[model samples]
Target: MAWIILLIVGFVGGTVGSIAGLGGGIVIVPSLLFLETSLGVISNMGPQIIVGTSYLVLIATGLSSTIAYMKQKKVDFNSGFIFFIGSGPGAIVGALINRFFETDQFAGVFGLLMIGISLLMFFTKSIKPIGIIKTGKLHTYTDENGMSWEYKYSTILAIIICFFIGILSGLFGIGGGSLLVPIMLLLFGFPTAVAIPTSMFIVFLSGITGSVTHVSLGNVHWLYALALIPGAWFGARFGAYLNRKLNEKVVVTIFRLILIIIGFRMVINAIIG
Candidate 1:
């Protein structure tokens, strides 16, 4: 039953994640925490284990989505790679910091972070690209359908934001796409179409780094993670397909609601426990 639940959760997570460019970790982590609490699966260690497992699931989901996005030529490899450079080291630092928190403490922090992310997602409005800085080398990308986009941003700002996102990713076992996508859209003025795939690519890199760190810390449960793999892979493909079809505003609205609900639940649980 537990295995079955994990599989189902993984599929749902992957699907919504890919479509919203939020990554599976946002869904997987909270769902796993709720499941464990309800089922009495692991007692005191449940939250930590759930976080670890979410990262593992994220690795698979991120890779699958990134591939799909790549095939569509929707990903900006240059910008994504630049973000990845900062994320890698930041993930390691976050993992190291995670070692100091107790399970409840971790849950509290994760929940609060989720709430903050939800608020950011909810309040942000779409804006046209403006005040383009012409100093840096312009990065241009052409999608599979011959659509082109060009943009430039401060390298230092990109690094700072990506590094912070990576820390949250590693600490909470999120893939960082939830935060990254929004940052790209709001801060860097990236188009929705461009931000989703580019964020997925960055998430893939950070997921790998965070997953490795969690594995080294003995936080990941291999059996649970293994159960999630197949479902996440197929679901991610389906979600990426839907990304082309669905309305971005609708997707983001749903994403924000889910985050708020889960975030509140986790925070309450932490306080009560």
Candidate 2:
């Protein structure tokens, strides 16, 4: 029964995460905790195991979405790789940091993070992009309407920002795309079309590093990951398609509310525990 529930959680997490470019780990981590602590549907999953398992599932989610976006020529591999330069090493350090926290403490920190991300999503569009710098690596995107948009960024600044993003990813088992997409838009001046897919590419790379670190530390719950992987992969593909077809504002608004609710719940639970 728990495994069956995990399948659905994975599907929903993957679909929502991919469509939003946030990665499924946000939903996966909280859902796992809820199942373990609230419902007792699963047993013996500590914060470390939950985080490790979530990152493992994110590998599938990120890969599927990235592939789908790539087919549409939406992914910016050059930028993504550059961002990974700092993120990869940062992820290693974050995973190490994650090793110290037990359940209640981790829950409090993670809950606050989820709420912050929720607010970020809510205000995504209203937040204006940073003014064009015109002094760094310039990139352009041509929309279906034949409008051309160009953006630029300092490689050094991008790498520095991504390092902190990677720390959050590895520490929290989130895709960090929630953070990455905005930075790409606000700081790097990436067009939305390019930013979303590029964010997923970075997620995939970060997932690899985060997963490897967790596995080395024996933080993962193999059975939980097994239950989640297949659904997450296919759901991400479906989500990528939906992302191309639908207006994202509605989806993002609703998802932000959900994250807020879940975040507050986790925070309360941690306090009570």
The residue-by-residue lDDT of candidate 2 on 1-273, one tens digit each, is 999999998998888878878888888999998899889999888998999999999899999999999999989899899999988888888899998998999998999999998887666677877675557867888987898998888888889989999999889898788888877877667888888888888889999999999999998999989999988998899989999888888888888899899899889989999
The collision pairs in model 2 are: none
lDDT of each: 0.80, 0.88
Model 2's TM-score against the true structure: 0.97
TM-score of each: 0.92, 0.97
Q: Output the worst ten-in-a-row residue range by lDDT, candidate 2.
A: 129-138
| Ten contiguous residues minimizing lDDT sum, candidate 1 | 125-134
